[model samples]
Target: MSVHELAVTESVIAAISMQLPDSQVAVVHLEIGRLSGVMPDAVRFCFELAGEGTCVEGARLDITEPEGTGSCASCGTSFPARDALAVCPCGSADVTISGGAELTIKAVEVTDDV
Candidate 1:
């Protein structure tokens, strides 16, 4: 999973480079979820390896941990969850995940050419 994510990130950076031919990316903001099955440490490690000799090489990576959210159908209540165990305070097993399973690039910082 980590290898795949690094490959995907590299692809995204390449796409961005095409749009900003004169500028270089300096940083990338990533949103990582606990349930996304991605470890932050592993991603950071793999990013360095994957970015070798690329335009995104040596770019700073900023990661955000998004908490999981779930909604209860019994009492129409929504609350934050920490993990896959989504038991509502109202004791409702009928819950749907609303967030925290996403891995995405939120923003990219680019350096203007001289």
Candidate 2:
């Protein structure tokens, strides 16, 4: 088993446990950046294994990929930047990343059995 995905998935479980210690989670929503270097499928698989016997056990992991964005310092312009190291639209390499490269827990669904 790869440690990378397991580590991240464990973190997610820990975070959820902190807030909803009593409730059982049914779904886990995560926002994955296109340039975040994390594979959605791999994370999902790890989540299944890591969540065993926990509140997130058998919970579905919903991963959403947001579009990458950046801004040009020279031209004061903004555009989509799927690649973080991509150049600016004004023929300049001076581009600042505005979005993407994110791995966040968006939301969680739990039954109101409490």
Candidate 3:
């Protein structure tokens, strides 16, 4: 288990636990971009253990990974980027990348028993 992912999952669980102190969390929706420097698999692996005994325990974790978008400064063309160093089809090296590197909690679902 990666310590980074474990710590991140712990924090996420703690936040959910604090918000829904008495509720049983049913799901957690998250967005993790491809270039976010975070490994989705690692986060998934850490979720269960990190959420143990908390509101997030046993909750389903859903993650979405947005692809990297890049815009070429030279050609003004926007395209998908496989990596930070992606070159534009126009052969432009001056590219600005975005839509990758996202780590956010989009939503949370809880049981009515709370």
Candidate 4:
């Protein structure tokens, strides 16, 4: 896995640990967009390593990848944006990517403290 993913995972664990210091994390819900530049697989691979000895250890890593969306400025058309440079149906290159490119932690599930 990339070091970037490891850093991201560490940050995630740090945030969760800070939020629910007394609880046992059961799951980590993540939303990784296609344009986000963060790989879901890399995060998954690094989760366990990052969460070692932390509350998030052994926690389930839930990731969701949202497809990128773009809007055409010339024709006012909205379409899927698989890449940064997207073309519009009207043969216009003036497209604005609206959605995707998000790496969010939607929710965190925790188990009851013993």
Candidate 5:
């Protein structure tokens, strides 16, 4: 998983670098929810490895995991969800997961070489 995360981070660096040509990445902010099935620490560690020899090298990785919430359509009850297969306490499979499934790059800070 860390290996995959490294690859993903590398790709993100490439994409973001294109947007800020001749600049150095200072920080990378991300939102990794509980249901996203990713470990923030692992991702952060891998990010450092993946960023080697790239503009993202030495950049800080800020990760945030938002709380998970879901609703059971069968009972119209909303509850906390740690994963997608959150079974409602009322014994219902008609569950709708909300939040906690995000794996997004919120922001990227870069410094122009100038």
Candidate 6:
């Protein structure tokens, strides 16, 4: 999983660099949810290996863990759910998950000139 994530992130950075040839990326903000099945520590460890010799070698990685959100089937109320427990306030076990499975690059900080 960690190796896969590293490959994906490296590819994304490469694509961005190609599109913006004049820019030097400084930071990459990543939105990592608890339900995303990705370990932040694993990703961070592999990121350095993946970025070796690349333009993002020394770039900073900012990870954000978004709270899980779910909708209760009993009351139809949507609210933040526990990250791991994922229990609804209404005590309904038939809740449908709406969010917290996201793994995306929120933003990239870049310098026009280095």
Which rank order by TM-score, best down to worst? 4, 2, 3, 5, 1, 6
Number of residue pairs clashing in candidate 3, backbone atoms closer than 3 angstroms, sequence gap of 3 or more or interchain? 1
- What is candidate 5's CA lDDT for residue 13? 71
Off by over 4 Å in 4: none
Reference-based lDDT, each prediction:
0.78, 0.88, 0.89, 0.90, 0.82, 0.77
On lDDT, the leading prediction is 4
Model 3, range 1-114, lDDT digits (tens) per residue?
999988888888888888878899999999988987889999999998888888888889999999989999999999998887889999989999977877899999997875
Positional deviation of residue 2's Cα in model 3 after best superposition, in angstroms: 1.0
- Candidate 1, position 102, lDDT: 87
What is the clash count for each candidate, in the order shown?
0, 0, 1, 1, 0, 0
Q: Which whole-number lDDT from 0 to 100 does residue 114 have in model 2?
A: 48
TM-scores for all candidates?
Answer: 0.81, 0.92, 0.89, 0.93, 0.85, 0.77
Backbone clashes counted, model 4: 1
lDDT of 1 at 107: 89
lDDT, residue 8, candidate 2: 83
* Local accuracy of candidate 6 as per-residue lDDT tens digits, 1-114: 466677666766777667656667788788888787777777787777777776667888889998789988899899887664566787888888888888887888886666
Q: Can you write out model 5's per-residue Cα lDDT over 1-114, one digit (the tens) per residue?
A: 577677766777777768766678898899889887777777877887778878788889888999888999999999999778899989898999988988888998886653
> Once all C-alphas are superposed, what RMSD does model 6 give against the true structure?
2.6
lDDT, candidate 6, at 20: 59
lDDT by residue (1-114, candidate 1, tens digit) is 467677666666677667765666788788888777777777877777777666667889899989899999999999997777788999988888889988888888877752
Model 2 lowest lDDT segment of ten: 1-10
Better of 5 and 6 by lDDT: 5
How many residue-pair clashes does candidate 6 contain? 0
lDDT of 4 by residue, 8-82 (tens): 889989999999888899999999999888989999999988898999998999999999999998888899999
lDDT comparing candidate 4 with the true structure: 0.90
